[model samples]
Target: MLAHIGGRGFPPDEAAERAWATALWERTGGRPSGAPVARQIDAIRASGDRTAELRRITAPTLVVHGDRDLLVHPSGGRATAAAIPGARHVEIAGMGHHLAPGVLDRLVDLTTALARTHGARPATTPTPTPAPAPPTEEPA
Candidate 1:
């Protein structure tokens, strides 16, 4: 499962892989658990083609995929972008299905730029209403 999600050249660091495996093992009560992994595989298999629905999307869409992604190939991203109207596709080189160091920041920046370009406004906190003016004291 890790290999499928992380790609063949994933981790790039044996220590990182060991740490991840240890954490996963701890999370799974130290027993070799395959339920979650099986579920992910099943989900992928069950997901039917949604190209028609994808083409119907009118909102500004961004399809970002790792060029080295093994689970979902870059072609999938290209096809998704092609299907959506005016969708932008970004292929990051040397990245895989798993999040690599510093990739999240790049993704955030890309999304932020896209949102800015598309005039997406950040949620604003509503200004608090001023307290009702204290009742004026009656003149003697």
Candidate 2:
């Protein structure tokens, strides 16, 4: 579960994994308790479908998902983009549920571009030219 939820895209970082695992263990009662985790799972299950509420969101939205995410499946991101008007969905290849160290710069670039185009507050990261979309073939 930790492997799937944490960085599954890149090579394992034992130090980082240990740090997060320790922090999570401490948060969930130190001696190992699944109650908090169970409650979270229950809450998510109880939330029901929220398509109508998602449609009501008017802000410029970006839905970024990992193509390899096993924890939340890539389809969830697609559905979210479909529900929200004008929401742009981006699926990063080789990414899982967590952001691997290698993808950080690319994410920063993508987000910076989004913020700039939307006229949001200035971003500290210098925005690079956004990657061009892959060309699609039209049926003749």
What is the C-alpha local distance difference test score of candidate 1? 0.83
Computed on alpha carbons, the lDDT of every model, listed in order, comes to 0.83, 0.84
TM-score of each: 0.73, 0.75
Stretches of candidate 2 above 4 Å error?
5-8, 24-29, 123-140
Ten-residue stretch with the least lDDT total in model 2 = 4-13
* Segments in model 1 whose C-alpha atoms lie over 4 Å from true places: 1-23, 127-140
Worst 10 residues of 1 by lDDT: 5-14
TM-score: model 1 vs. ground truth: 0.73
Expressed as tens digits, the lDDT of each residue in 12-36 for candidate 2 is 5678878999998887677887778
